[model samples]
Target: MCFRLSAEGTVLSVNRYGAEHLGYERNELVGQSLLRVVHEEDRPSVSRRLAECVVVPDTTTAWEFRKVRKDGSVLWVRERARAMTKPNGEAVLLVVCDDVTERKEVEQHLLEQRAQLRDLRLELSLAEQRERRRIGAGLHDSVGQDLAFARMKLRELEAETLASETRRCVEAIGQHLDEAIRATRTLTFELTSPILYELGLEAAIRNLVDRMGAQDTIRFTVRSSGSDETLPEDLNVILYRACAELLLNVRKHARCSEVEVAIECTEEGIRISVQDDGAGFDAGGAGKGSDRTGGYGLFSIREELQPLGGRFEVDSEPGRGTRAVIVAPRERTAIADAR
Candidate 1:
């Protein structure tokens, strides 16, 4: 609906649609102050805008404000207006308004839904982390302890003088038991690193790289700087997990024989980069989850860092190797509270 108003905000004329929209007759609104229909709380701003429009008659301005209807109900309206001079040389405004109450309500509902989803994701992620810690503890305390005890008993049996054939069998059994114990420890560490909780991110990562290097499948090197500063526990976990996932991807998919893991603290935050000399896939395809070797590890890493206000990036080309970078903030209290 369109209307004209005097420079002072008196309604010069309003179309029938405009009058009916406000639940008033055109004649009744014609001489009324435009502020009479604007919601009281918005009147000051509307007044200032109108004064500005008069002074800058060539420019158009738009705003959204609440308007009071004849029965005292309020609804949102979007106004587009520009100043003009009447034939009589008096300044006026040609204003167009549209009822936008429904649109605003929809937008608000969408925002609320997005917030709910974010909260749900955070709760689920935290719960998953707790479950992993529980399983890791069980493996270390229960299964690992049992294996160690059995190995000790085998050693005791070996200490006794026995027939040559039986002694040989006992030695074999002891070796197998030792392997089982090592396997259990590796599994336990993979599930969760206690060092992450007790020491910090740097120690946990160092331990991870050390373990990987011990396997002799791939040569791993770690170069770190400025890692002594304390970080939020959750942020530390996220960065550590991101690094772990990327390294695992390198070991599994990158055909390279060597990998480099670098950790550095900067003025902004901490950065962890994992680089592999392995046969790399197309970075674009990896990001899109289209590369057969890419799997979902990189995507998972990205999702993990997003909530901490961190960033994840991958650079690679076929045969050029891949580099995964994870960055986390120095101060994460506000980010943690947002969760």
Candidate 2:
């Protein structure tokens, strides 16, 4: 849930989840000091963290802390807090947190037991690609070889036998086998794109943009700016998927013929935007299940965007096209450097 507080820690805004969890009505939470809800153990650390953020007001941090519920139950929470300023130049804070007590506990336990969670993450990535290659090898080595052998035997049968119907059936079976092998090859590449594993994010994206542009019905263009420096593979995947989602949303909800995808990188952060020339609608008209519909595609995009020092904004009108922009810290990539 989201909470926007004034400099004095008075709640100026409480999201629907915040209002329900704080055991306060919508109006009651406003103007209430959020410090009252801080669990005693975390009060010192939480306050310290906040101080560290405000002192510089440039660096951002994501943290996990405990907070006392009004019902007297303490929940382990993870906070995505950012330090900002109000119009009057007062320091204001906006926070989004989740009751991840159970999840945090699980992560903590795993951390303690596995001493190699970071290593495992690295291996998990490599292993995921290795497994894809293995599947590809299976298709090429076993299935592909079988198809070749079958075709050879069928050609021999065609030469030796005189039954026309039988020869045609044999050829068809051979064709099916060849088609199956081709499909398997395609599946392997899609599962773990070789370009990403072999080259890097920039080249892979360039290739992806080229492929997208080559499509017949819809036209696509991509603009890359900012730091094109190498980044963690996981960041590449997240950014790639986020862009892919936007384009897909365009294909589904937008009836436009062309779209533009742009990426900008700076010392502090990176921004990605996907804009379309299709019909748009009132974002406020979205309902709970709108996410399942085309309306909430941007919402899902935000879910992926926010975790890594990222944020997203959607702009659209009834007739004007939709533009989704994602902002993220350049250093805050999902995949850390290998130890």
Candidate 3:
């Protein structure tokens, strides 16, 4: 059990573990600020963090310090917190506090090994993406075959319909069934592009965007001279998602009926530009969910693209339309193809 407290040296709640760990009787620290037990040097930082957290929401922060026990011994604690608004309309902060001094020391010792796995590296990620692509392809090959079989059977059933109207109805049903299978195929590829495995990421993007263009009224294009296109998995995922989000926005918004997508692999890294000749708006305004189509398309696009040390450029004028560019790193494994 953990302890909870108000910012002011008053404890609000204490769980069994907290009481036992602190050598405190059940009544001792209740209704206390809990910070009283925090080491003196750590107090100011703790206070500053608490003050900063008040206005921010869903932010995470952690601080480590020693706490004085009832027996006069000190134990270290790592406290992490987030700002919250309680049901009583009271301003409150929820905290997950732990005695992590020992664990932190152990983690510090193993940092080198752990960093390789937990921290995402671009080149390594691309290799992983290729693997995922392979897996996705295998799934599609196996499941897709089954879907084809089912579709074939459905078509045979449709052929048995004798009456014209009944045959028409059966045909409609078959059409829908085919469409469902197609949707599943799209999902399988979207989940992991086999193209990245067989065709590589660059060609995969070209194929995906080209297919999208063929299906919609959007005018799409890819710009690149040298096609040495290999990006690390982390970067590839970001690039792919950035492109996907941009196209989705155009499809749903940029009512201009035209879109252009460009990919450039430069010495510094990779950059993708997606433009739409549709209605644009002020990028400065708030996009809270107020019937604005979930109000998160652009935000998601930025978040997905930015983490790979990439830069996203947006150029849009209300009448002129919108353009977005994302720049990041490039890897090896360069090969190109048309789908």
List CA RMSD, all candidates. 6.0, 13.3, 14.8
Clash totals, every prediction: 1, 0, 10
- Angstrom error of the Cα, residue 314, model 3: value is 1.1
- Those runs of model 3 whose alpha carbons end farther than 4 Å from true positions after fitting are 1-139, 149-180, 286-296, 331-339
Per-residue lDDT tens digits for candidate 3, residues 21-87, read: 8887768777667667777777788778876766675687777766777777766778887776677
Give the C-alpha lDDT of model 1.
Answer: 0.83
- How well does candidate 3 score on lDDT at residue 74? 69
Over 1-339, each residue of candidate 1 has an lDDT whose tens digit, in order, gives 788999999999999999998999999989889999999999999999999999999799999999999999988999999999878888999999999999999998998787566546655666667788899999889999999999999899999999999999999999999999989987878788899998988889899999888876899998989864578777776677668777777777789998998889877789888898888887886655555435546666665566666778889889988888888788776445655
Q: Top lDDT: which candidate number?
A: 1
Find the 10 residues in a row with the least total lDDT in model 2. 287-296
Compute each candidate's TM-score over C-alphas.
Answer: 0.66, 0.51, 0.49
- Ranked by lDDT, the better of candidates 2 and 3 is 2
